[model samples]
Structures are given as structure tokens and as C-alpha cells.
Target: MKIPQKPNDLNEIFKNNIIKLMKLFEEKEVKEFIGEANNKYIHWDKLRRLKMPGNEKPDMIWALIKLSRMVTYRNIKFNKYVFNYSSLSEFQKRLHLLDKGMGGKILSNNGSVIISSQERERYILSSLMEEAIASSQLEGAVTTRKLAKEILRSNKKPKTYSEQMIMNGYITMQEIIKIKEKKLTKGLILKLHKSITKDTLKDKKYEDTFRDNNEVVVGDSIELDKIYHQPPNYKEIPKLIDELCEFVNNDEKEFIHPIIKGIILHFLIGYIHPFEDGNGRTARTLFYWYALTRGYWLFEFMAISRIILRSKVKYGMAYLYTETDDNDITYFIDYNLKCIEKAMRDMNSYIDRKQKEQTELLNIVKKIKNINLRQAELLKEAVKESEKPITISEVINTFGVAYDTARNDLLQLSKSGYLEKTKIQKKYLFRINKDKIITELK
Candidate 1:
């Protein structure tokens, strides 16, 4: 309960532009701005949420990551890039420069490439990501263990949070369908408990936050950087947890756009900061879980964490921005809206790429002179899997084949041009041309 009272203080965040934008955003027209910023003389070029489902909708993470792309696209549309770069990387670099020069980074309080420990800020980002994804795609959840798996998947060996390694991108997410059928026990919980830091349980930092201890305060006497630096007041923690659990579990707003509801839950739970450690990660994962509960994307991919990793500065700025203005949530809303807008555009682009890739694979399949029933079955399975590129080992197991025999079939098909090899790590990945196979079947 010890909140910072000044800008210079670590707990205190003051950002005037955010306040100014909130005032401007109060106008009702701002909420309707899908394409209006280009012609207006507004202080901030606010892009409104389209409230439309993407052509090929993504899950929670997909939605967050896509927002980055959407925001980038909108910036180029409304603001000049001053270059005709042929690739997205080149384009992004130019835009990043322009954004920095125009005070985007400053306005966002993100001069540093990596954003550090500000549990409150992470809470806000989690809420924003949930809202953004719900608005464009279906609902879903990101489990803590799932996230730990992600961190593990990245092939890093920090053994602890450090630098950019603190990113939530590494959280492993499995489909809700995959989790609901299971039961949680002491063993399961403890096994998964290893995913986060153990000191978090008793570390005053985690304790203050999880318990919601009100004794902590950011008065003039306390050092500035240490304000958001304390723990949560745990005395009344159960009350807030019950309140959010009730709302999330049985609220009448079930019919409301799951995205909006997800955002609301994110704020409440995060505001509660229920865990000793990994509260931020927990809030975000909860948001993901809430989205998934309402029926969302499968977890073969993750995008929201990626979005957090990407616009971390803006993510932090939103938190600090609100602090300077008597805790007015309007700036917070605007910041999230922008994030949502960006997610939509990113999803659009992803859908476009996925469709394009599938199209090319289909063409490759059709040109094949001969494909028997067996290859046709494998092709069907690949399409049905519909996740990241499937590996050669998967093929061998799919039919319970001998290693060399499976290898021969894959090599022959790859050589004959029926399948494409996307990458070669421990094993190769084979992508079949489903579209071509369908055409041949027709």
C-alpha cells in the first residue's frame, strides 16, 4: 500500500504528455477513430480499436505481438518514414529512428532497450495484452509452468532473471483443452512451483506485494527509486482475490466481449498482486487463461509476451504516466487502446503471411506428378496438426515406422518436390502441399 508520491522517486511516475493525451482522449470522437487521425490536428494520433475479428484470428499472444505491427503500420501511414525500405527490418529501423527523434521514446519513458523491475508496470502490460487479444481473437490462458517452459525453450542459461532475460516471452502456453482435463495436487503444484524463484515466497519484496502490506509508502522520506520497490499488503489480500475470482468465474458479463472482460480481470487481479514473486508473470498468464476460457487460439504460438518485450518502454510509460495524474485511468486506457490497435494490424499481417505460405505449399503439392493414398493421409495429418512446422521425427512416430524407412520416405518426398524443408536442427521439418493435394483429389 506504500505508493510513491513524486516523479523523481522510483515509485513515483510523472509523465505530462500522457496527462495531456488523456484530456484529449476524453472527446467521444476519439474512441471512434479507426481512420481519422491522418486528417486531424490532434496532439496525439490515437488509433481506435476496430472491434472487428481478424480474417484469420489469433490467440492472446498472437493478438499482442500483432498490435506492435499494427501500430508500426499506422505510424507509417500517418507519419512519414522518409525512406523506401524494401524489408520490414529496414522499415522498422527507420521508423524507430523517426519515433525516437519525434520524442516517442521520451514520451514513452523508454530510452533504455530493456525495462527492469517495476511490478506495477508488468501488471498494467498484462491487462493491456489480455484486452488487445480478446478484442480481435478468441480467449485463452497462459499457465505459469507454461511460461517457465517458454523461458526454458529459449535456450538461455541465466538460472535467474537478468537483463532482457526477464522478458515474459519465454512462458510456455498449452491449449486450455490440454489443461482442463487434468487435476492439480501437491505434487503437480510443487513440481510446477519450481518454474519461478523460491525466495519470492518469503522475500519481503514478494511478501509485501502478495500480502498487500499497507505500511509501505513512498513519502518524501523514502528514496525515489524504491517506491514501486516495496511489497503488497497481504492483510486484505483474500478479499480482492475473492472479488476477482468471483467476477472471472461467474460474472454476468460472460456475453461481453471476452477481450474487455479479460482486461477488467487483469487490472483487478494485478492491482491485487496476489503472488510473492512472479506477480507480473502471473497476472499476464491469468489474463491469457481468462481469454482462453472464453474460447481462443491454441497455444502453438505466443504473441502478447512478445509485444510486451517489444514496446516495454511504452508499457512502462503508461504505468508512470498514470502516476503523475492523480491515478486517472484515462491515459492507461489510451495506452492499451494503442496496443490493441497494433495487435489487430499485426494479426492481419500474420494471417496474410500464413495464407501466403499455405498457398505456396499447395502449389508445390499440385505440381507433383504422382502422390499415393499414403502421402495423401500424411498430408491430411499435417494440415490437421496446423501448428508450427512439423519435424521429421514426428512423421516417423505418426506411422510407427523404422527410422531409415521414415527417413527414406521424407527424403524422397522432399527430393521429388512434394514437401518443403523449412529448417534442419536435430531433425528436419516437412511441410506438405495440402492445397495441391486437394486440387489433385478434385
Candidate 2:
């Protein structure tokens, strides 16, 4: 991506057009335009293209927007820099919706659970797989989503470096869930990085350790000459990380909403670039850890990375905008909040689709007597792909059921003529008995 043009200095614009700017601010249309611009948090690059009202220049409008934001910006000290962000109306509206949606209040009108206990596990597993694949893809992992899901579900050893990256991401996400209760520490961060970069980095020593040399610069992968960011000096990593741990662990000084805090943690890791590889994956995992630990239970079902992967350029620009524009992290925070909102919407759509599928599966069960819900689901899947053989292990992994339970479900379907079972070596493969199912339904 090309580097964004740095915003013109706000002070210079104010100094040059003091009387004109003051008079424009009093105009109703100018005030309305400022409100609209601030709500979207329009950066100068895009702001400059907008048609100015009453023949005023776009930079004057940008100056006014910056002036308004400065009043509400809150400061955070990180190492030698002081970063700030403002909670605009847009942010507040989204946060309110997210709090209502993700704070364990996901229920139907009847006050019963929207996602039942049985469905919760399946959704969580699907979400983890999605996040793993997309996060790896964001880092340039080359694999189809279908192939990646099959690799994860079959628990097979990855055959390529790209697959290895995806597998590492999956394992790291699971590990984050397991250790969500622990406080953020440099050690914990290293552990997560090790899991995320296992067998994927060129050097083994860099897997769990910070880089000792300032050789790493985030540059455009295509152009190779355009540098996007240069992280802090390598020698300062330990102290910077120490300060980061304290910032995340202790919340007494000020009140940052849990979601915002999580996004900030995500941005800091990317900014710090403490490791030689897998910094992006580690940063995203830490965001999930912070959110899950802070009681956003619904995040386990939301794949924010999947949404981010759809707009990879914007994701990169959010960081660039924050860094170039005087460390005003509102750009990063705003981008993440929008991604989270989309993820939440996607999660709800997924639940609705799954619920519809379950209803259809129930209808199938009514037609096929003596079959359980699990068997009915298998039949539904088999109907969709009759030629593909289903294995006991696949069933177990998909449903999170015991080995015996998966075996019994497949065997019962075979005996009932809903599936055709064949033994190859010591393993049994089940396929849809298309003729028998057609005859029975008739």
C-alpha cells in the first residue's frame, strides 16, 4: 500500500486563516459538515477530496474537525510517546450495541437462551477455525479455507509452511482461551508468540524471544522500498513490554471500556513489533485473551480476523494513520470497533443460519424414524456430498463427542440403511446410502 499523505499541520491552518476559520465555524453548514466529518473520523487524505461547503477549503474543515476532537481526546503514555483517542458519538453508539450484544445478554424474546449449551461448543469451534485460517491468511498464508478447515478437523500434521502457520494459529487461539484468566505478562506474551510461530519461523531461537537487533522494518511486501513503520529500538523492548504489562493488568488509574482496552492491546503489540515473526498473530490472540478474560463471552463465537481479512489494506492503514498523525490512536481504535461490530453481526447471521438448519434436520428426523438428531445431521451432510466418505474421527471432531459416541452414531446410521459402511483396513468409512434413503422417504 502507498503511504498516506501526512495531514497538514492543524496549527498552521489555524494561524493562516484565523478570521476566516472563526467565521466559517459560525456558519450552520460548516458546523454541520464538521459534525458529519467527526462522526466518521475522516482522515485528511479522504477529507481533502470532499466538496467544500461555501467555497471553503477542505484543510480548513479538517482543522475544525481536529480542533473538536482535541477537546475529547484522552491521553495514554507508552514508553516515550503519548498516544491519545477520543470516544466520538460513533464509537459510543457502537460500544453500546456491543455491550448489549456480547455481555451475556444474548437471548430470545422469551428470555431463554439464543445459543444453547449444545450449540455453543460447535459455534466456538467453528469460530476458532475461522479466526485461525483468516489470521494466517492476513500474514500471507497461502491455502484455501476448505483445505485449512479439513486440516484442522482431521488433526493431521501440516504438510507445508502455510499449513503450519494455520495450525500454529489454531493452537495459539486455543491456548489463549485456556490461559485467559492469567494476568498479562512478558512471559505469557512470549509463550503465546512461541505457540503462534512454532516451526513457521526460519530461526528456532527467534520463536520465543524478542529481536536483539533493529533490523526489522515493516515495509510494503510488493514495493519493498516503501517503509510503513520502524518499531522502537530493540534495546528498549524489555522496559516497553514491562510498561505494557502494567498498563493492561492495572485499570485503577482510569476507566477504559473493556473492548477499547482490548483493541489498544492489539494495536500496541503491532506497534511494538517485539518479535522477529508472528507479531500480528500474537497481537490478535492477545486481543481475544483480553476480551474473553474481561467477560465478553460472545467473542468466542465472533471471528474479528475474518472481517479484518476482508479489508486488509484498511487494516494496515489504520496503523499507519495512527503513527503518522501524531500518535492519535483513534484511527486504530475506530477501525477495530467497526470490525468488531461486523463480526458480531456475522455471528448473529451464523446463529440464524444454524438454527434454520437444525429445524430442517428435525424435519428429516421426523421422516426417518428410530434416528437420533446426531444421525439426522450426518444424513443431512451426506445428502449434500454423497460421494465423500465420512470417518468416525471427523464426526468426533465436528461434534466434540466421545469416540464411542461418534462410532455409535455412524454405525446406527449404517444399520438403519441411511448410510453405507465399508471397512478399509482397520477403519470404517460411511457414505450416504442414496437408494435406501430415497426408498424410505418415498
Candidate 3:
């Protein structure tokens, strides 16, 4: 993407006409515009396209909006730059909703747990695969979602670099969950980076180490000549990272919400660009790590990257807006909040759809004498993909159960004529018995 237009300086616009601008802000139309603009956190590029209220110029209106934002801005000093964010009404609404949805039990409108304990593990596994694939894809790992899921589910060694990236992401995500309770430190960051970039980088030496040179710049992969961001100097990385660790580990005097703090951590890794490669992947992983550690347990089942992949342009523009508009990170914060909200919504929709399917499958399978919920779920998958064979190992991974338990579930279904079991080589493969299942349903 091309560089965004830098916003005009607020001081320059309001210097001679501070009194006139303050009076103009009281106008009804201008008040309405400011309210609407603040709700969406509109940046100058988009704001300039909108027609001004009455006779007001866009730049003048922008100055008014900036002035309104100044009162609510909370500042953080990182190195020499002063980065700030405003928690607008919309932001608070989102944070409240996200806290309600993710911090406690996720419930539907009717007040029922969206995911039960029995099925929570399955949902988390599926979401982790999705997050891993999308995160890798964002960093230019080119592999089909189907192939990536297959590689993860079957525990097959990745034969290609793209596949390796996906596997590394999956591994790193699991590792983050295990170490969520640990304090943030430079060594821990290096360890996570090593796990995320293993076998995916060109040089092994750069795997867990900070870059020593300043050649790295984030640019548009499509438009190779257009540079989107030039990170801080390589010499500043150690100091920057030390500050970041302190920021993450210690609670601020003036309360910064955990979600917002997590998003800031996400942005800092990208801004610092401490590593030669895999910085984007590392940044995203840190976001997940921070959220989960803060007791937002429901985040384990929501893939924010999947939602982000759909609006990749907005994701890039959020970073550009923050950089171009005087180090105001509200733009990036707003973008991520929306992504998190959408991911939660998407996850709920997915769970609802799956619940409906399971209800239907259970209704049909309840006619059978001794089939269990696990058997019903397995049968549902088999019915959906009748041509694809199922393996015990896949079931073990999907259900987070042991090999014996998975094997027994399939074997019982096979013995009851719901599935046809055959030995392929030394491993057992189960196929849906289409005719028998149709007769039973009928």
C-alpha cells in the first residue's frame, strides 16, 4: 500500500484562530460531526473526504475533532516518543462487551454457556489451527488452509517452508498457553521467537537473536518498492525491549485496561522490529499471550487473525494512521478492538451452527441403542465428508483424548454398523457406511 497522507499539524491550524475554532465547535452541526467522528475515530484521510458541516472546512473540522480528543488522551513515554490513546465512548462499550464475553463464561442471549467444558478443548484446538494458519499467511506463508489443517491434525512433518511456518505457529501458540503465568522478560521473548521462527528463517543464527543491522523495513509485498514503515534504529532495540518488558510486567499508576495494554504490546513489537524476520508473527503471538495471561480465557477459542485476514487493508492502514498522525495509537487500538469483537461474534456463530448440527445428529442417532455424544460427533463428520477416511489419531487430537479412548469410540461405532472399519497397511481407517446410516435414519 502507498503511504497515507500525513495529517496537518493541530497547532498550525489552531494557532491564530483558537478563539474562533472554540466558538465554531459549539455549532450544532459541528457538534454532531465531532460526536460521529469520535465514535468511529476517523483519521484525516477519510475525514477529509467527507463534506464539512455548513460552511466549515475539513481541516478546521479536523482541528475541532483533535481538540476534543486531546482531553481524553492518556500518554505513554517510550524512549523519546510520546504515544497516547483516547478511550472514546465506543471504545469503552467494546471493552465492556469484550470483558463480559471473554473474562467470564461466554453465554448466549438466553443465558446459557456457549461452550460446555466437554467441548471446550475441541473448540480451542480448532481455533488454534485457524490462528496459526492465518498468522502465517499474514507474513506471506503461502499454503492452502486445507493442507495446513491436515498437516497439523495428522502430525505430519512439514515438507515445505510454508508448511513449516504454519507448524511453527501452531507449536508456538501451544507453548504460550503453557507459559502464560511466567513474567515477561527478554529471554522469554527470545524463546518464544525461536519457537515461532524455527526452520522458517533463512539463517539459523537470527532465530532467537535481535537484529544487529538496520536493513529491515516493512514494505508492501505486492508493491515491493513502496515502503510502509521504517522501524526505529537497530541500536535502540535493547533499550526499547527493556522498556517494553517493564511496561508489560508492571501495573500503571493510572489504570490502563488489560485489553488495551495487550494491544499496545502488540503494536510495540512491530514498531521496534527487534528481529530480522518473524517480527509480525512474534507480535501477534505476544498479543495472545498477554490476553490469556490476563484471565481472558475465552480468547483461547477466538481466532482474531482469521477476522483480520479478511480486512487486511484496514489492518495495514491502522498502523499507518498511528505512525502518520503524531504517534496517536488510538487508530490501531480501535482497529484491533473491532477485530476482537468480530472474532468473538464469529466464534459464537460457529458454535451455534455446530450446536445445531450436533442437535440434529443426536436426534437421528438417539434412535440407535447405545451411541454416545462422541460417537454422534464422529458420525456427523463422517456423514459430511463420506469420501474422506477418518483416523484414530485425528480423533485423538480433535477431542483431546487418549489413543485408547478414540479407538474405542470408533470401534464401537464400527461394530454397530455406523462405520465400516478397514485396515490400511498397519493403521486402521474408518469410513462412513452410507447405506447403513441412511437405512437407520430412515
Ranking by TM-score: 2, 3, 1
TM-score, candidate 2, is 0.95
Model 1 clash tally? 40
What's the TM-score of each model vs. the native? 0.44, 0.95, 0.94
Residue-level lDDT of model 1, residues 1-442, one tens digit each, is 2332332321222232335344433545433342233222111112222222232211221223222233443110101111110113433343353233332211112223221232223223333333323211211222243343333333334354331123222222332224543332222222222333333244635523343456543222346554543333666565545545555565464343444455545444444445544445555555566655555432112345555545655655555444443333334434444554465445445545544544455554565456543354456556666464545554443443456866677677677655677666665778876664566556
CA-lDDT, candidates in order: 0.41, 0.88, 0.89
lDDT of 3 by residue, 1-442 (tens): 7677887877888897788898998899899989999888998988999989986788899999988898889999889868989987888899998877755666654566656788778888899999999999998889889889978987788998999999999989988999999989999999999999999888999999999998999987778888988989999999999999999989856678899999999999999999999998999999999999898888898899988899988899999999988889999999999999999889888877776776786797687668877788888789899999899998987787789999999999899889999997999999999998888877
By lDDT, the candidates rank as 3, 2, 1
Worst 10 residues of 2 by lDDT: 105-114
Looking at model 2, the pairs that clash are: none
lDDT of 2: 0.88
lDDT of 2 by residue, 1-442 (tens): 8777888888888889999888888999999998988888887888888898887888888888888889999999977978999987788899999888765645544454556676666678889999999999999999999999888887789999999999999888878888888999999999999999999999999998999999899998789888999999999999999999999999999999999999999999999899998999999999999999998888888899999999999999999988877888999999999999999888877766776777787888898898877788889889888888999888876777789999999998888878888999998999999998887777
